[model samples]
Target: MGWGWLSYSYWFPRVHSQNVPNSALFYPAVDTDVTPCHYRIPAVYSFGSYLFAFCEQRLDTSKDYGRMNIGLRKLCLKDLGRCEDDSEWSKFCQLPLLEGYRTMNPCPVGCKETGKLYVFVSAINAKIHEAEILKGRNTEDFKLFVTSTIDCGESWTPWQDITYNFNENVPVGSKFVVLGPGHGIELHSGRLVVPGYFYRMPSSFTEEILRQMPNGRKSPPYNNVGCSFCLISDDKGETWNISTTSDNFTYCVVDNMYRHMGECTIAETVPGKLLLNSREYGNGQYRILAESEDGGTSWKQGKVCTQLRDPTNRGCKGGLAKLVLEDVRYLIASNCGHPSARKNLTLWISQDDGATWSKPWTVRDRELCGYSDIDTYMDPSTGTAYVAVLYETGVSSYSERIDFISIKFSEVLEKCSY
Candidate 1:
């Protein structure tokens, strides 16, 4: 709640009738059990006729750390690329949890060549909080695992520990590494890219320093740097590589202590070009934008996109997706439109490959919302393109419900009023 200057809210001159789309309550919060549960971090993936929604079911509290499991709901598109009806979605089901560990970050990528759905998750010791990992307290407390479903959501392969592939190539001084916490992308060349970020421990970090720190420090560890990149897999999900080229990593300058990049999303702008959109964690209210020419291997220097405004202090997670309309490409994104608090969930469109974006149209009308994922599909038979969003929204807080909404590309074009 101590958003500080980043909590500056933009109040429009006038309020207009909301152009809300058709949305269904996909994952509603539960208060019936002794341990009330709330769903957060929504990610949506579309494969064939099914669209899968995934989130973290925080049992007992809405805090990041606790007993958490990945919750999934499968929706069948009665008509290809359509899921407006709530009846199309299946009941929410809790995914199998790693014993003694809490599973977070539901990053799923579908393979175009093999038709398999892969979900990457971070398994952490339930007792080990993110603060401990950032402080280098116990590197072994974090691990990365991925599971796949060849038959859609009907079944899944056993979880495979892929931590070695990452741990071995972590940046020289990285301590904390995490997955997309959203949906991943499969490029045209069949390269799978999972958006990720890691924190690099400064040379000043030491056990003695940890002991000397204040009991309840509010700010992040001093001098610790955060960077954003993608995890690449060439031969499906058989093996992986971290994008470590000098140009591949994106982070803000060290002049500001709290200005760090985190929780990013990626999309292929064209055949050989890629765009990585990340949230600036500190007082930087603008969304950070970076580009790569050769898939996810390397990236251009990152710059803040003034067109997209993010709430200050741990900016909310947004979704990115690309769609081709009559040979023209467009990038669609969703996030909190407000500059100060987590409110005014909005949708934006970039026509010139993210060079500029239209003024976003509010999606939630001042409702408290957080974390969203955008996915698009074109009906083969009709050639009609549609975009779908899975997001968390509530009146008083973000821990209310994860909702699903879909609108046509035609509607997006009409709604994106410059």
Candidate 2:
């Protein structure tokens, strides 16, 4: 058990650290006209001896607000520092992962038991308009889909439409549904869970206008209310089901904050227990917590974890993962540790499940550090444990490039200790 370190407050004093030593950063340079922004929500999955990473390659920004195609790259876990040689990374496909629709938020999960990898993605009809949305036209325009790879991402199956699986259980008037822009989880018992959210436009236009208006709102507006949930699949990626959605009313402290449970990440705390850490827009500094005992089919609201504070009250999405070293379980989280800006990208450790966390170990202390994803890679030959974080970083803004940093298990333990 990892309880020996539980007595001490895990929170370390914020230090002006610079970067993780022996880490490499990879940047993909492309002609801006063809690809405007990478729209950094990068996801990494450790399969066998290789690591697969993905991001949204935004194309035609002038026309489409955020029209992008999924771009994938792979690197050997043993050769992290050598990724800078463009030839070392491979871009398997140029065509959009899912065509005809505008896709965002790609969540990738791998099942070692079945040796299959699943990628869950969300898409909205690029041509749909606000007027049509208001009239309940093409309400299913915003949907979730999944594609899988049995050959370690060398090839992928056709995009499978799984929107109906969630729509059947979503609340009335729900107009939007999305999956994690990060990675998903496969429990010890072989159950697959992908974190996601569903939302409906408010009855009154005021809430919608206030929330949607600021982000350069235009003709086709986005939904204002978001309640997080998990898409659970027991039969691998063949079939799926929806979990009980988070209770927004009771979980949120302020009435105005009720509608904004944004992107989420899930990790198994123990044998049968799962913890969900979600991004709350109205209350950005604190992350919302929820728990599920029955394999993510049902969830109970947990209090806000002020110990896990992000930079801004308008919180940005982060990454979470669970690791076991020497039979001691630890949870690792990555996010901007500040409370007002997207800087001080740090990694936090929790020894006692998700109850408490150690002081953050700075990953990158820069202004434009945005969304990130975490995954563990264990070398079978030497039994070495390594954690890799794929995050967004830039000098002036958040969207210049996506970088991958690999930290050894010893490095994490050394930095997390007092």
Q: Give each model's clash number.
A: 1, 8
Clashing pairs in 1: 7-340
**Alpha-carbon TM-score of each model against the true structure:** 0.89, 0.83
Put down candidate 2 lDDT per residue, 1-418, tens digits, no spaces. 7766643234334653557642223344543345334546788878766788887776655132457677777877666542333455564354235666877678888888778988877777777643465456787676677888888777788888887886556655566666897888889888998888755555533454345334432222354555677888888767887754533211333333352676889899997788888877664567777788876877775457877875555688888998998899998888877667776678888898888887667767544677888888776656678888888777786666777777777788678653
Candidate lDDT scores, in order, read 0.78, 0.70
What lDDT tens digits, residue by residue, belong to model 1 across residues 317-415? 998999887789899988888777787778889989999997777866757778889998776667788888888887677768787778777877677
Compared to the true structure, candidate 1 yields what TM-score?
A: 0.89
As for candidate 2, its clashing pairs are: 10-358, 10-359, 11-359, 12-359, 284-313, 311-338, 311-339, 311-340
Native-to-model Cα distance after best TM-score fit, residue 248 in candidate 1, in Å = 3.7
Best-performing candidate as measured by lDDT: 1
